[model samples]
Target: MKRISRREVLKTTSHFFVGAIAGAGLNSVLQGCADTSSDQSAIDDIMKKTEMADIKNIKLTVLYDNVLYKKEMATYWGFSCAVQGLDKNILFDTGMYENTLMSNMLKLGIDPSKIDELVISHDHPDHVGGAMMFLENSSDINVSLVKSFGSSFKKEVKERGLNLREIDQPCLITKNSFSTGEMKNFTKNEHALVIRTNKGSIIITGCAHPGVVEIVEQTKKITNEDVLLVMGGFHIMNDLGTKTKKIVHRLKDLGVNFIAPSHCTGGEAIEIFSKAYGPKFINSGVGRIITANDFI
Candidate 1:
């Protein structure tokens, strides 16, 4: 992990439950996602581990995605990212297949054992399928997911002695990291990751089911900072020609400095983004590694 004195971060357990925003309206969008006492305990343990570690540069490596940047590794219709330089190493999502996800991670020189926790984006096969394999074989590390997940899946995770953090609201993940809780709207249940950097915030989505533009807007509003970058699946594969023109422009309008659209972001949408972002566009795919320093 990398270290440097940070500007401001939560240092006590009391601050952990309040969430990225105390009451960011949500306008009842996340309706029916209630919480339990045990669920609260799970999240507490996951966030309290390394409050001492300072953040410097956050290294985000796309370990698994639909696009292939390095032909040496296998690509699948899924998404996963390796988050480094924080207090604990985090695997953002598990991808579609366990073997393929693991193979690509090793090919990229990432050690599975070094991951301290796993933050699954949603219940989709492409996102959570590979997780079962890792969770069954691993121990000690925490698995953070939405509280609305099926009981059988949660049962299996607890059976392995792996800590489970049932996320319901935006909360701290580690020192500078946070989960947008779980947003549900057009698609299904999903969440984005937020890493507070010195410049601004880096917001990562699994399949912006709740709307990519909305996610960026809410994060910027909650964090009180402009978004430096927005990466991961935009899930805009089905839009017609030029339909995404406004979305890309809206992102740029939202003060997003860099854009990395991968996974389900579709080729047409990617092209439009490239034209919109110009030099700031990143060809994000499997094996692509980006750091906060690269943009800063």
Candidate 2:
């Protein structure tokens, strides 16, 4: 095995979105011969059978982000969140800079060694920057990411003796959580985390390249539950005018009760979401914590 630089990793991953578009087309061709409905039915049955503990509270701490809620915390062009109070302590994505991510995590008292699983939303450098650092600290953790992740990235995980699970379709990540699977549009391949609670389901995304509304719909299809909250990067920074507003309406129509847009979601888009969601719109940034009870 050979060591690869972060720059090389970034270079390789830069091709993912374009490749994903091509791959998605091929997948459609292949699925044309298969019974997609049966597959979906099986997934629904599995989702129904998945048992979750009666979670009274779920805590999500923003470990890395482009925005800062606490002045002492570091902010960067990336995203990461620490999810606790569930079946497993999951670390979602790793912000772009290793030192910054570790510093923020340390300031927040979040130990990477305690993470039961690491769910990466994609292979972008910002989303995966601290992955190697986290892997160095934790020995017994499972890593989940889209199956379309670059080979160099996968090789790094294998070389580090990390347990890696490649996700292609909606699958149960834990007793109470399911990944919305790999969703691709024109930009990148990403997956949103879906956690089912007594109140409803929560969707956590990283740079929603497939459209946030589509991600929510996919989660709904798998969990068959109303979305209690939809948080994370919406990737709508460049969308001017009525586009962002239409997306907000689409999410509302899909039964999304709350919104917390961060990172690449842009200031304008966040403002739009803030006005639309009103009190339900959470101010998310580094060190921001949201619990399950907050939704209720």
RMSD of each: 12.3, 6.5
Pick out the ten consecutive residues of candidate 2 with the lowest summed lDDT. Answer: 24-33
Clash pairs for candidate 1: none
Question: Which pairs clash in the backbone of model 2?
Answer: none
Q: How many backbone clashes does candidate 1 have?
A: 0
Best by TM-score: 2
Candidate 2: tens digits of C-alpha lDDT, residues 29-88: 111111234547546754775665454758889999997778899898999999888878
Candidate 1 lowest-lDDT run of ten: 1-10
Please give, for residues 1-296, the per-residue lDDT of candidate 1 as tens digits.
11111111112211111113222222222222234244354345434431422225578899899988877879999899999888788999888777889898888888898898788887776777677556556766778887776555565566556677777776667677777776777557777888877767888889888889988876765565768889999988998746689898788888999999999999899988998888888889999998744673
Candidate 1 Cα misplacement greater than 4 A, ranges: 1-56
